[model samples]
Target: MPESLEKHGVSVLVLDADGTPIATVQDALDLLVSASYEGAELVAVPAGRFDDSFYDLSSGLAGEVLQKLANYRLRLAVFGDISRHLRASKALPDLVRELNRGRDVWFVTDLDELDARLSG
Candidate 1:
């Protein structure tokens, strides 16, 4: 996806929903680099961009991807409905809750929700 910049209360790099899926840690790193190159404070990725393994906590893809972003001090906003994944995993809901409480990562239902969070 062509990285697009959106300036709300914060500078955000928004990825298109129809773009290529992020299937590996390398993909996440590439995205992180893109955000950094664009001098964005946050990167908003469509939830659908992530592979299914990302939502399956047992696969450890989420942890790896998140840790990489954290290591670089890059904030990420995953926007889209991930309710199906949340419902399937007993641990995911709590994990999302905790992440939402922090500044590093946020799981939002839409850009509007992400906008609200950034505005706050």
Candidate 2:
């Protein structure tokens, strides 16, 4: 079952344990549909739900998925430790920093941080 949080007219759906890895735009679409069905404006996901390629800037999967989510006007928060990937790539940290600056997407370290963000 999906966990949820509601405050300030925003509802967030926290992806359940064993969330499926996002491999394509369709995967992101599916999550959007699911979030809509749950009446959630934001979807809180764990970083592990994304494929390795999603972290590889050359693959373009990250941009595509995030764009799809943004096009739908749904906020996405990816919570977890992505430090290894950050350490491996030169561009990822900057990408993450930029993404976090926008209201449409965020990368957080834990649920409490995500909660604080969503609450705001």
Candidate 3:
């Protein structure tokens, strides 16, 4: 589990299969809250490669996660290529674009971009 918050002074939690983020949306939210409580300005979630056999984005997990973040007033920065989502659903691209333009959500391609966004 490679989880740490150290990208341009922003708090980051990288979640892979080895970590606890795969369990549930609440688990991920808890982690973010914990980080925020510890004075983290931003949270980066790099969860890529969804398991086709078990996980599905259309199951409302994304909305649940976003709702939780909004409730907490925490900005979420998702890093990595989400081409699969764009290919699966056309709405995802627009959603990402809109979120990036918003105040609390961002879909970034690299740490540099994330850093720039968080900084500016």
Off by over 4 Å in 2: none
Writing each residue's lDDT as its tens digit, candidate 1 over 53-92 gives: 9999999999999999989988999999899999999999
The clash number for model 1 is: 0
Index of the highest-TM-score prediction: 1
In candidate 3, how many Å is residue 38 off? 2.5
How accurate locally is residue 78 in candidate 3, as Cα lDDT from 0 to 100? Answer: 73
Tens digits of per-residue lDDT, candidate 3, 19-84, equal 454345767567666766666656666646333311244777677777877877777777777777
Note each model's CA RMSD in angstroms.
1.3, 1.3, 3.3
Ranking of predictions according to lDDT: 1, 2, 3
TM-score: model 2 vs. ground truth = 0.92
Judging by TM-score, tell me the better candidate of 2 and 3.
2
Order of models, best TM-score first: 1, 2, 3
Each candidate's TM vs. the true structure? Answer: 0.93, 0.92, 0.74
lDDT by residue for model 2 (1-120), tens: 678778557798998648678888789888888998998988888889888888889899999988888888889888999999999899999999998888888999988997787678
Where is model 1 more than 4 Å wrong at Cα? 1-3, 6-9
Candidate achieving the largest lDDT: 1
Model 1 CA lDDT for position 113: 92
